[model samples]
Target: MTGSVRAAHTALALTNGLLIDGTGAEPIRAASVQVDSEGAITYAGPDSLAPEVASGTTTVNVGGNAILPGFFDCHVHFCLPGGAADIGLTMALPASLKVFQIAERMRTTLEAGVTSARDLMGVDVGFRMAIDAGVIAGPRLVLSVGIVSSTGGHGDMTQLSGINVLPYLQSPGCFPAVADGEDQVRAMTRRILQAGADVVKIAATGGVLTPTDRPDDVGMSVAEIRAVVEEARSRRGGVHVAAHAQGRRGIQNALDGGVDSIEHGYDLTTEQRAQMVDEGTFLVPTLSEVMGSLDPSAGPVALAKKALWQGKARTNFPAAVAAGVKIAAGTDAGAAPEHGHNLRELGLLVDNGLTSMQAIVAATRHSAELCQLDHLVGTLEAGKRADIVVSDGNPLSNIQLLGDPANILLVIKDGVVAKDRAGFLTDRPVSPR
Candidate 1:
């Protein structure tokens, strides 16, 4: 998302394309969009009826390409490297070097057509600030900053032998909060909000990635979970709370405790889906990581953990969809293939019964709502931020094309051409296809 394409346009018009708009509506054929200098959409609709572009506007004929809102990943861990769980090695990386790796991965994410990312863990406030200030070309970042876990919980990162290794790992401005009581949860919730977390992630249950825990083990009590959620609500900007819960009881406790969303709800049941729908708790199935965890190559412990939960996830996801649960897209990007392959999640969702268009909506408008950025992005509607992706094929017809970044011809963020592989797109107007 750099080079000459970065700031190639302020007033821009991309016309004669198929626009999905991210609204779950049918694609508008012969579509167009006009973006103003402020990076807001001035017009979006049929190309024949598009408003005139401002004087000096840069117009590019899209040549019948398929345009859609930039994708969104509601869960990610950019600082955690792929395919390994050596806390000692990870903690030993110098802070400066870790930041460099995070920044570099962010660039790859942006070019992959992910314009907005909600980092659930392992990213610090500094990275968010640097991305916002344009110090690095990356997606707009939403940060949870640190994870909150009970002692001996999934995020504890402490091993047997009483090593107390959890304290040794820290991301510049990020650190986990280990608390056991309601008082500790309340106090730590305030501290995390004070630390500039846009959201809060509570490990309400043991997770697959941890060494000594079963996925069905509920970690935090309902009272403790309620404390964190209620305290986070009291903070300014109404910070969101996402619960990492996999067990049935844990998922129910997190929902009752007021978590805004549930991440990797591996063992959630049909009854739970009904409750989630009633409670309006969005579910982010990080299916990519679940798929990877079952890859056999992720090692015995990882594979064993996933073995207990994958069956339920494989079955429960479609049930959740059938029950009309609010579902968003997330890949758990750091779990496998690291960055640059988030689009694979859409294909996974489709494999689990979501139509290509439904999966696209899950990644677009729905994911935006989960990230608390629906007003700013997620759709190519007038007055929204001009974050759009142009793909070589009509993804509604061949959704798998997105799994390959080369099919992504262009990526525009805030009216700037962040990526443009389309040789025909230039400052001057061109003939329609």
Candidate 2:
């Protein structure tokens, strides 16, 4: 019963581990998790309270490791491979070759124990369908498909030379749109939705990576941003709107325009944080983006822009935490940090004033809430999908342990063993009795 747990038809039971349920609660020692064949967790609590396992059920003894809900990254980019300053590397590559690299990044992300992620841009619906149909391996994705930026804004992939080659790179389900005014914003929003966006991403401010604009410069006008929100609600009533907001003015504009989440909130004032808390807006502090972009190799334009905002996150992030703004984990993978390094955000969250448990909650529960997927996953409670991770060490004691894939001993998604470094389930194939 105690061996390598196979991804099979039989039930799964993980026992003898410390469970952090992703609810900001204290960890329970000697916990057990029971996943039914349909991939729903039937029980998750202290081992003494776990029901008796039936015959043929694979029982995994975690050996006092930490059991947690599968992590989530609220912001990531599967299109751009991380560790580079060139956001437009995919611009030159043909779509055929680019897709294969994107698929590999998805697999790498899955192996890192991230079960779900919200892709802010560059991932198309084809990738999502492939993962769902078992054609590829990756996290459950909530895709924006592409970003919406104003002329010369951050999402504008156009070169300063004025040649707009972005349309050439548009695939079947990906469409990045740039508009100048309310009417254009509305039309572009419709185009993004028509291209199969689960969420609408609007650039409320400039970004560090874009050469055309400064991060503090406001990108979209208030009316233009409102137009996007209005169009998104009309197209998909429950669809979420996220803003790539870094500066204070843009953050205020996004909040005023009714954005659901703020990405890379670099220069937030106390009033803005209070406003965000009042509006129930989530903040995805992508510390990984800041940390990863610090590479001097990225060039002077990028390095100077990065330097402008680098010291700000260290001060602002902890203050946002103290001001009670809802936090979610987002690494901005592909922008700076690589895909598999998603969990590094959790440790950065800890360093930014969140406790280890709170950091886990930010990655798991808060992220799910931001993605509007909390009911299906995010926690270890019964009735939730059996998306879980068993780490070789306790993350509460050393949160950085979750950052390393080697320490992730097991990864289960929807009751199927995705990765198992430990021999918890038997290698024997399930017999068709």
Candidate 3:
């Protein structure tokens, strides 16, 4: 139950469960999933049609639990500690202490049934490499490494005291990401790419937390955003660009500049929603971050901004959902809710307009597609990575069940059991091959 790899029975199967599969399809009754030793799913369907596993393969009876694909969060910040005074707390802490906090957060996040995450900023490539090397327990990471911002933009750490505290938020592999015109934005984008960014994150508008600007204030111009998109696309693998677009003008500019996804769309217009659907653009609604930003410990400016936007966020997100825009679940963890509570976003999505199953797909398949890992994860099926989760009960009836880590019965990432709350693996002895 605690090892990095299963000892004798490398392959696994969870029989006698209801499988949700993350496909937005109706649940399959009497389901079973078979994972081969290589961490690939060999079978995932009705128990009647499931192929027989090898003799030594461990089989777990889930006691009629709900089986699902491991969840994925599209937007998260491992560096922030999800505190009301995040900026002050980060500035006060030493880099070494922050690293330990990041590790612990990642562990809790994985145990909460999140198998993969896309870190928007503040995390470097080293963390991803460490997880891949099995040096630590964490969800598979896709890192952005840095955020591209114009001077005094949301990502800029310069305060009224004339201190730039950006160093506290980044590791050695990250760059100081403040740029102005198109040329500077392009150079900054290249530097971030060289530092191993999987996605290019740019702030197209201001933010609530930054004292230097208001959320409605435009940050990057259309040409500057386009520069970032062009540079990222020129890369060998064609990196995608995500814009921190909160206001209507910034959102329109980002869409015009051809960014792949819009983050924190607090003022999304009806035209923007239609445009997003037509262009297949994804909307990552960080509702939890914005709504939870009304912490008493936050500064007066931040509190006021958060209060103003709270109503708009509730309205705009539901409108976007009704407009048929592609939705991806991203809590913007480390801002309000901590990493392990990522499932809270699903419930928020359901409240906004999405049904329970639609919200699950947004967290799983849609999020995977946004992270560019859909081919490997997102759904329970053959030829996919065996990143699976078994919930204590059906989430369709009560989606809030997934909001608590205690309800997550089993978490298997790449055929490795990361968390087994019900002793599904440890309770039974492995059969000899």
Candidate 4:
């Protein structure tokens, strides 16, 4: 082919691919996708009806590969390393080292076919800006800067310290803050927004990761949660709050407080599930975290937690599905098994009672809706960004293909091909770390 022919500025067409658009519809066979110079999909369907590719256009022969919308990881931490607690006293490492660690995590995430990620906590606004400016090779980011919690609550870093230490000398980073009362909660929420958070995250319940609190304990009061919701709404951005709830009362409080989504509904009751469906509240089960905790090799704490909670998750999952609760996918990446292996969440969802299609939707369209980014990403359709992933085999037949990056032949983000079988090649190279 001539150099001019190879250097196209117009449409880039992928022909003869099996298309799964992430809309819960049946797959389309022998399809083609035409992307314009502006990165919008101009046409997608049968190759026979695809718009003509003018001169100097690029073409890719998909050879019957399965093309689907890129995956989204709803719960991730871009600024914090995955095993932060494991680092112990090394947590005192300079901020720059933390930044580089995050950069590497982003690259690994993208390489694994996650084109977009919603960082639930511990990501600064500066990190988001860096990714947006193409200074880092990371997924599109929706970040919650830090978490707000009551004194000694799930996010209270103070709990991790020894009793001999003076609390006044402590200066917390992005992990969590100990705020109390409605006014304090409101102030903290605004502070997070002002600090560049896309959404405000609050610990409505105790957590498994933190040393002191029980996962079932209600950590934040209804007034505190409401203060955050009200303040966030006044900004017109409509803040989305992710509640790390694991108990019935905590779930109730989260729903009543106008939390957009409940993360890890480990202890929610049938009544609470029905209420969630009735109130239009979304649930993100984060099945992979449960599964990871069950792995005997994952260590005693994780294994013990899983042994205690797995039965609860098993009991709750089918009930939530039966109750018609809107479930989304999130793995709590960075908590265990790291960031890049997010797709393991999908398989775990399916294993936990979700049909393969439902699990896929939870990770894509449902996740986008939860993140309020459905208009920009999610389903593959005309006028949407050309963020696509092509796999060597049918992912529906075996979701495990998603867990391994090698099975993904292509990954495109914003109409730019970020990864091919040959490896990373782009006009603008964003350093991984």
Candidate 5:
């Protein structure tokens, strides 16, 4: 009974720690967290202020470690394999194998302190259901199901090989939604909505990974762009569209089309940055993927779009920070050179002109807002879900400490101790929520 969904009547107390509530507030030293076993935070503040715990409570003393809201990655494609950034190798792989690989990657991601993820493309409700049903161990997922793209854009993983890639889409979690005009875009949006997508992701511009396509190319026409956003907006639960935009004009076009967030704004301008602020569009800088691609160790094909990202991003990123543009931490995980290294995105944000605390907030609360899950996750306030991480190192002073899994001693999701590196508890049951 130790870790097996300690009964909802049970209680868990995490005491003697520094609390970083993920609200951009100063960290509280020697704090405590009280979780009423249904997994809601009963208290999260100064240690002395904690309410009296009922008898039979399980307590964890983190030895002055840091307790914070579990991190979130707003942009990831869990359906893709790590180091499969190469087109031919990725295309040649069978969908059957890739499907199971997602479950394994999900477990790896959860242990990496990512309690939740917003899969920009190629994840359906089945995986989410499996995780919730205790059939798999992974992050809580908000799926886009599949990406909607204009014929030759980024999501158009249509290969040069004579093999018909269209059938690939019929598989559960495959590449894209290709459409030419507004009618086609609308039809595809409805189809994806019926697939149980929590959001709709569109390729507003061509991208680095797609062969023979320039990252700066404004791929999708405006009418089609507007149609996708319009259709998604009309859906129940207020489904929003996320645009994979990199070029300056394309970034503007995406905002103009009412995209909720812009992924990889590499060549953004000051005007575009200001517009993003005015329009309240969140920026998910997948800096880790960009910088990792530039490393010679990442392979040549993976490096094909190195120049597309490297230069302008470095300059405009800091400018966006200065202009008050909201930054969200997201590593384009699952593609080559990136996977469990999502925590590396925080350090990249710091290197790209954010302070340590700002970077932490970006990874936690801001990223949640970007994915439109702010109401439930993000800040560690009373009544919030008990998704928490206990880190061995103080992430505020040296942000890179989070990049090491060795420092992450505990990961608890929904009142269950999913991972316990310190042996504070004898077992890790992690029963379904």
Candidate 6:
């Protein structure tokens, strides 16, 4: 194509492709997309019905690739891999090294076709902004600086060994803002919001990473959770909160406290699931982490975590689906199987109860709605950002193709070709060789 045709202002037509609009609508074959200079899609339909193209606009022939809205991961930690216990080693590295590691992971994730992600519990807002400004290549990140937890709770980094031990090393973002009373909780919530967090993350119960506490033990009192929620609302932020809930009581407490979504909900009761439906709360089941623990090659800590919570997750997932509770996909990457392998969560969701389409919806549209970004990038609709992905085969029939980055032939972000089969638009080499 000529330079004028390749970089035009009117529309870039992508013809001869199958389009899944991310609205749970039936797929349309031989479709074309018309994107404008601002990155908003202006048209999408059968090629025969497509609007007239401008003279100098480009037309790409996809050759029958499957085009769909890019995937969204709701819960992720951008930190480099090391077990929960080894996070201390990351803290010992220079700040520059840590930033480099985070950037590398971001590139890997973006190249995997995840165009957007939510940082569940990390203080990487600077890194998030860097990606957005084109200083780096990565998904659009909605970040939550470290989570808030009670002393000795899931987010707490204090080590216990018969006698109270000194504080061990912890990653900058790993240390929870430990609060006790309701007043303290409210203050901490305000502090996090001021730090540029897009949402609030709270540990309502103990977690698998913390060896001492049981997953069922409720960490924060009802008063404390409510206090934090009220504080978040007072800022006019609509600050969504995700609770790391496991036990029945903890799940109930989080729901009653007005949490937007429940992270694990492992061991959740039938009554709790019903209440979730009534309250319009979303359930984010990170099943990939649970399944990873079953692997013999997994670390002892990961295996222990899976052993403790897998049965609960497996039992409750189907129940939540049956109850009509809104389910959003999350993999809790970096906790077990590591980041960039988020698509495997779809298989676990399918094995649980959701149909193939339902599972895919959970990862795309539902996840965007959960993050309150549906207006921006969830679906391939008019006036929405052109964040699209093209895979070699139809993902609706075989979701496993998503797990192989090579299968993703094209990744377009904000009207720019971030990744093509040839390479990234930037000078940097393509990953996943």
Best by lDDT: 3
lDDT head-to-head 4 vs 5, winner: 5
The candidate with the higher lDDT, 2 or 3, is: 3
lDDT tens string, model 6, 168-262? 22224434578888998888898888877788889999877666887888988888999988887777557788898988888889988999999
The Cα error of candidate 5 at residue 186, in Å, is 1.2
Better of 4 and 6 by lDDT: 6
Q: Which tens-of-lDDT digit does each residue in 1-433 have in candidate 2?
A: 2235454555889989899999888899999999888888999999999999878777878888999999998898887777753535656677788788888888778778899989988888988899887788788999998889988888888887776755544444576587899999989888888878889999999988776788889999888989899888786557899999999899989999999999999999999999999999999999988866467776788887888798898899899999999999999998778889789888888887999989999999999999989999999999999999998778999999999887887888878887776655645442111
Poorest 10 consecutive residues of model 6 by lDDT? 1-10
Clashes of each: 0, 7, 0, 0, 1, 0
TM-score of 6: 0.90
Candidate 1 lDDT score at position 221: 88
- Between 1 and 5, whose lDDT is larger? 1
Query: Can you write out model 3's per-residue Cα lDDT over 97-157, one digit (the tens) per residue?
Result: 8888898889899988999989888899999998888888899998889889998898888
Local accuracy by lDDT, each model:
0.83, 0.85, 0.88, 0.76, 0.80, 0.77
Q: Model 5 off-target regions past 4 Å?
A: 1-10, 84-96, 164-175, 294-304, 427-433
Residue ranges of candidate 3 with Cα displaced over 4 Å = 1-9, 86-89, 428-433
Give residue 52's error in model 1 in angstroms.
1.4
Of the two candidates 1 and 5, the one with more favorable TM-score, higher being better, is 1
lDDT of 2 at 405: 87
lDDT of 5 by residue, 1-433 (tens): 1123222334789888889999999999889998886788889999898888978888877778899899998888786665644445655678777667778888878888889888888777889899988888888898888878887778776678645454443336444678888999899999999888888988888877666587788877778889998888888867878888988778878888888888988888888888889988888878876766454655576475676477778887889999999998888886544667678888899998999999999989998887777887888989988889988768998989898777777888877777777766654432211
Ten-residue stretch with the least lDDT total in model 4:
1-10
Instruction: Mark the 10 consecutive residues where model 2 has the least summed lDDT.
Output: 424-433
lDDT of 5: 0.80
Q: Write the per-residue lDDT of candidate 4 for residues 172-282, one digit (tens) a residue.
A: 245355689999999888888887777777888887666567788888989889998898877746868888888778878888898888988988898888888887888
Clashes (candidate 4): 0
